[model samples]
Every structure is written in C-alpha cells, then in structure tokens.
Target chain A: MTARIYITPKPDILDPQGKAVASALHDLGYQEVSEVRIGRFVTMELKGSGSPENRQRIEEMCRRLLANINVETFKIEISET
Target chain B: MTARIYITPKPDILDPQGKAVASALHDLGYQEVSEVRIGRFVTMELKGSGSPENRQRIEEMCRRLLANINVETFKIEISET
Candidate 1:
C-alpha cells in the first residue's frame, strides 16, 4: 500500500516561508497568485496490505508523528494499486 | 470548483528541507519515518465552473506560477462536488 500525506499550516497560523514564496511570486509577475501557503506532501510505501488494522495504525501514526497537533494539520490518502 | 495541487521536488533534486525534517522526525523517536520529503499541497477554490477549458487554464497557471519547471513537479486534482 502507498500512503500520501499532506501537512499544512492551520488557517490561523502564521507562515513566514509561505509569505516569502508569495512575495517572490509577486515579483515574478504572477499577480494572480494572491494566496499562497507552503505545505508538505509525504509519500510512503507501506509494507502491509490494506487491512482495517493497518489503516488504524496509519491514522495513529499521523496523529502521533506525521502531523503536529498544534499549528499544522494533515490529510492522508491511501492507494492499494 | 476546487483544485488540489501537489508540488514536490524531483527524485534527483536535492532537498535540504526534507533532510532537516527527517532528522527532526528521527529525533522525535519516529524510527519508521526513514524517508521524508517536504512538498507543497495547494488547495484553491477557483471561481469558474468546471470545464475542459477551465482545467486547461488552471494547468497553465500551475505551469506558469504554482510550480517551478526545473526542480519541482506538480499534479492537480479538481473537485466540483
């Protein structure tokens, strides 16, 4: 199974890196790029079948390690193909 | 309409940020977090309705503004519901 995780800053959190990127975009003549927030996409190949237990374990991992409970949020997508 | 775009460094590209994150994860006692690369997941609520032309435009925008053609690659998923 493969798990793709996306971790991002919470809406109310301040994102300095994202702001810097946005400013760079503006300087690059991308005026339409109004809102920009930098996030993370982590892709992993898990060594297990797609069982309910495995899903639960992956969720637990997300809560514990893959995401920071404060300031950042995460979403996970799993694929069995 | 909404679009979720994932931008990431290519496999051969060097990712200093990802290395730093991996080290942090290791220090956090996540031994299983061996491979960690930081990427971007951009969620955008587009104004117009869903159309092929709209998708093309959005893709063009991604190529031009949302992603760097040299070291980063991007994939966009659109949701209308």
Candidate 2:
C-alpha cells in the first residue's frame, strides 16, 4: 500500500518561508499573489498487508515523528499501490 | 483563487530526510513501512482573476523559484476560494 501525508502549518502560525515566496512572486510581476503557506508532503510505501491496524499505525507515525502537532496539522490518504 | 503546489524530490535522488523519518517510524514500531519520501506542499492565494494566463504564470513561478528542476518536480492544483 501507499500512503500520503500532508503536514501544514497552523493558520495562526507565522511562515517566513511562505512570506518570502509570496514576496518573490510579487517581485517577479505576479502582483496578484496574495498569500502563500508552505508545508510538507510525505509519501510512504508499506510492506505488510493493508489493514486497519496498519492504517492506525501510520497515523500514529504522523503524530509522533512526521508532524509538529503544536504548530502543524496533518492529513493522511491511503491507497493501493 | 487558491492554488496548491506539491514539490517532491526526484525518485533517483537521495533523501536523507525521508530516510531519517523512515528510521524513526521503524523505531516506533511501524515495521511495515518500507520506504518514505518527503517533499514540500505550498498553498497560495491569488487576488486576480483565475485565468489561463495566471495559471501559466504560476507554473513559471514553480519552474523558476519554487522547485529545483534538477532534483525535484512539482505539480500544481488550482481552485476557487
């Protein structure tokens, strides 16, 4: 199975990198760009059978190591390979 | 309009960050995880009309600044806010 995780900064958090990108876009004549938020996208391949247990384990992985829950939130999508 | 860009390392590239995450998952008992890849997810808000020209401009931004073409590839998704 394959799983994808998206980790994004919380709405209230300051994202300097995103701000820099937005500024750069404006400088490049893309004046329409209003805001930008940068985050992480993670993809994983699992070897064992696809079961509810494995899915729960993957979510646990996100909470434990894949995301900074204090300032970020994560979403997971799983599919067959 | 809102746009999302996903930037990921090329498959052939070495991703130490992904490796570290996989190792951490293994340590945490997620032994089923076989491989992992980490990338960037960027969300942007645009103030102007969502035209083909604006979409093309966004793609240009990805090629010129948002992604390192040599080591990474990017995908863009656009939608109304």
How high a TM-score does candidate 2 get? 0.95
Tens digits of per-residue lDDT, candidate 2, A7-76, equal 9999999999999999998888888889999999999999865688888888888888899999999999
Q: What's the lDDT for candidate 1?
A: 0.74
- Candidate RMSDs in order: 3.6, 1.2
Error of 2 at B71 (Å): 0.6
Instruction: Give the alpha-carbon lDDT of every model.
Output: 0.74, 0.92
TM for every model, in the order presented, reads 0.70, 0.95
Candidate that scores best on DockQ: 2
Worst 10 residues of 2 chain B by lDDT: B47-56
Model 2 docking tier (incorrect/acceptable/medium/high): high
lDDT of 2 by residue, B18-47 (tens): 999889888888888889999999999998
The positional error of residue B11 in candidate 1, measured at the CA in angstroms, is 1.8
Cα distance off (Å), candidate 1, residue A72: 2.7
Query: Cα lDDT for residue A10, model 2?
Result: 98
Per-residue lDDT for A1-81 in model 1, tens only? Answer: 777888888999988887876676578664544566777788765567668877776677778777787988987787885
